[model samples]
Target: MTLNTKKDPRVAVIKTGTTYPDIKSRFGDFEAWFIRALSGNLDITVVDVAAGETPDAPGNWDGIVVTGSPAMVSDRESWSEATADWLAQAVAECVPLLGVCYGHQLLAHAFGGEVGYHPDGRETGTKQVERLAASDLDPLFANLPRTFPAQLTHRQSVLRLPPEAVLLARSAFEPHQAFRIGQCAWGVQFHPEFTEAIMGAYLDVQSPELTREGLDIDRLKAELAPAPEASGLLQQFSDLVLQMKKD
Candidate 1:
């Protein structure tokens, strides 16, 4: 669907990669998860970059949501690079944007941040996210608690943020769990769009990796719970976009 001139804040889900193959066979891709997560009263669109779908114009949509991907930002694939370039322009133009996981790293890299293999290795499963003092100033996270849990699964992390980017939240394992570049642009390293089942499924698929990493798989799975505060960000973002459009 064309994003060119929608009355509603048409948010586009830019899919950079598919869900884990096993997860995809059982559930679906990242787009479906985001759609469900947001479930906001607004027009939503899906642009599958993996399938060669790209938005016609950023001005067309009121907001954008970049989904997580399996592809590492360090790889610098042509499509990923192109999407990053487009995201930079989107931010410059004041479009409300939220990037999660791979999208988070891409947003950082697009704006001159360093993204690479995490020294501590993959951080999978539900984890605690501590909001930094600066987070109080961000509308997207002001209402969240100083400390909360969010679903996470990633090997790469944004070791450094772009110049002047606001550090919003962090976890013990991930120093840059969330950040904001421009007023309306944000990048969260955690999966705010995931459910407990999804988290458990991810742990199941990554059990070997977790086992090798010395993490207790059963304990992690049993502890998985819905991250209401983290999950609430999707709707909060939509509200922000709609409110921006109103202003």
Candidate 2:
């Protein structure tokens, strides 16, 4: 469907990777989870940048959500430049954003932050995220628990942030787990949209890689522990984009 389908502001979801062969793909899970969390309120547009389609009219989109990709942000891939350019324009347009996993690194990279491969390889587990707010609180963190369970299955991370970006959350494994650029824009290294069951199936199917990397399967599964209120954060994400359009 086109953006004209709804009067509600459209949200553009940038998909930067291919679907998985063995199990549910990152994009597959994300769309299902995000749509469910959004409750079919806003119109959703997806741009498959990996397939070489650059997004249009950042100002037209109420907000942007960049999805996780298997590719590294530092890699000189064609899609990297395309998505980065859209990010810069979106920044200028002041469009809200939610960047997940590799999306977080891409946001950092586009805005002059650094990203690199973690020497420790990858941390594929459920981890606790601590809010490191500099102010009294952020609207996004309004009702969020002081400490909550989040699934983090990533390797590369933002070594630093853009001057305009603010750190919102962190974990022991990464200093920049979540950040906000300007206002209405957010990037989280952890997968707030990932459900435990989906993660469990994913880990089981990806056992070969887990075994090769010597990752603790138990820890990873545990990290995906139940979060009854986790959907609240995802809903907040879609809400932010819709609200930005009112301005």
Candidate 3:
């Protein structure tokens, strides 16, 4: 059933970037994963900031999943400012939040911290994350493994978290992988919603970036070829949203 604006959970998947050549900028793997997360039941609308906002559906939305952007988190631009406002508003309202990639960075920057280029090589492929006390305590990773496979793609990462944030997961490559704040807000450095195919396209789009950062795309592609177990992670994230709505 279509979730009426007056009832049912409403999730706003904010598109932070328009893909090059108009390759359907829905964050590569988000649309399908989101539809699955909502069990093809809830009302979902992808709000492209370039075109306009999500059309003021906050009254209708029960949750928000902010998508990552291709641009740098430190950049000062109109889109960045507007997106940051959305993040602040979401947290102030205590709306259930799940931020991926740039969304995660946006959260860190919005609350109180910095996100910028990491000298560490770009995390382009699949890797297993070591669980922490934060993970054990969080329901976000309920069904996921202690060391789960996740697709990593980005140039910038969370250097420091908002003081209230609790880290959820990490890896040898990236430490601030996943974190949460005050129970309802959560952010992940990796995309638990991406597929190898979708990521391959992202790599292709960011090949120049990889090269600029002195990394090898061939290696990144080879490592990411093996799909990560994000379906379970996404399911867990979805479950968290469902439970948050119930509360």
Candidate 4:
């Protein structure tokens, strides 16, 4: 898609965590995954917030994306809390924002929503996510089918949505799978940047935990598939940013 913009939209990717050493050695880290998924239309900058990197003010960028993290939102670590504050400010400024996995929970926590460990336990592997009727009005999710596959691996979730947040999607294992706050900010519990290979690596790394939790690793591995629709969100979001810039 061609954007009618005089300049490329500036997008900031807030990096919250790194992948496991093994995964990193093979598939690169979260920022690399996001960059690949987002493609090359916009000028992307990655801020490693997990490493105490402080980004500029929210208005400086045309768009923002917060990546998944191994760290839990409930921990409220100094860097995490500070990044949450930054995200809240970005939302207040009405900047287009997308948060995935831990970033999703952090967005909820930033806006007075409750987030914690799910009583039903962790959800991992390729799973189907059903878009709610409310998604019909959402720019990012509106064109997606009612149900589509997405890669997921998380133990904590947004238990309650923030005031004025619209529920967007849900899965069998996660009720709060996706939500949007105000108009420009959205959070998704699933990983839009993960590919089939990345999911397989994750499954292999978490095999012991899956076994201990009584989840069938073999089944999850068997069910692995590419989720093009879910992964397309990054480019859609990038297009949105460029369109907004054009306007």
Best by lDDT: 4
- Give candidate 3 regions above 4 Å deviation: 1-7, 22-33, 36-38, 54-60, 208-212, 225-228
lDDT digits (tens) for residues 78-106 of candidate 4: 99999889999999999999999999999
TM-score of each: 0.95, 0.90, 0.83, 0.96
* Model 4, C-alpha of 108: deviation from truth (Å): 0.4
Model 1: weakest 10-residue lDDT segment is: 1-10
For candidate 2, what is the TM-score?
0.90
- The most accurate candidate by TM-score is 4
Residue 57, model 4: lDDT of 97
State candidate 4's TM-score. Answer: 0.96
Residues 1-247, model 3: lDDT tens digits: 1233534567777767644543356443344445554444445667766455543534456777777777788885677777777777777777777888888888888888678877675787677777786567677765567777777888798988888888888889888998887666778888766766666777788889888978888887777754345545556656666776778
lDDT pick, better of 1 and 4: 4
Instruction: Give one clash count per candidate, in the order shown.
Output: 0, 1, 0, 0
Q: Which stretches of model 4 miss by more than 4 angstroms?
A: 1-7
Quantify all predictions' global Cα lDDT against the true fold: 0.89, 0.75, 0.71, 0.92
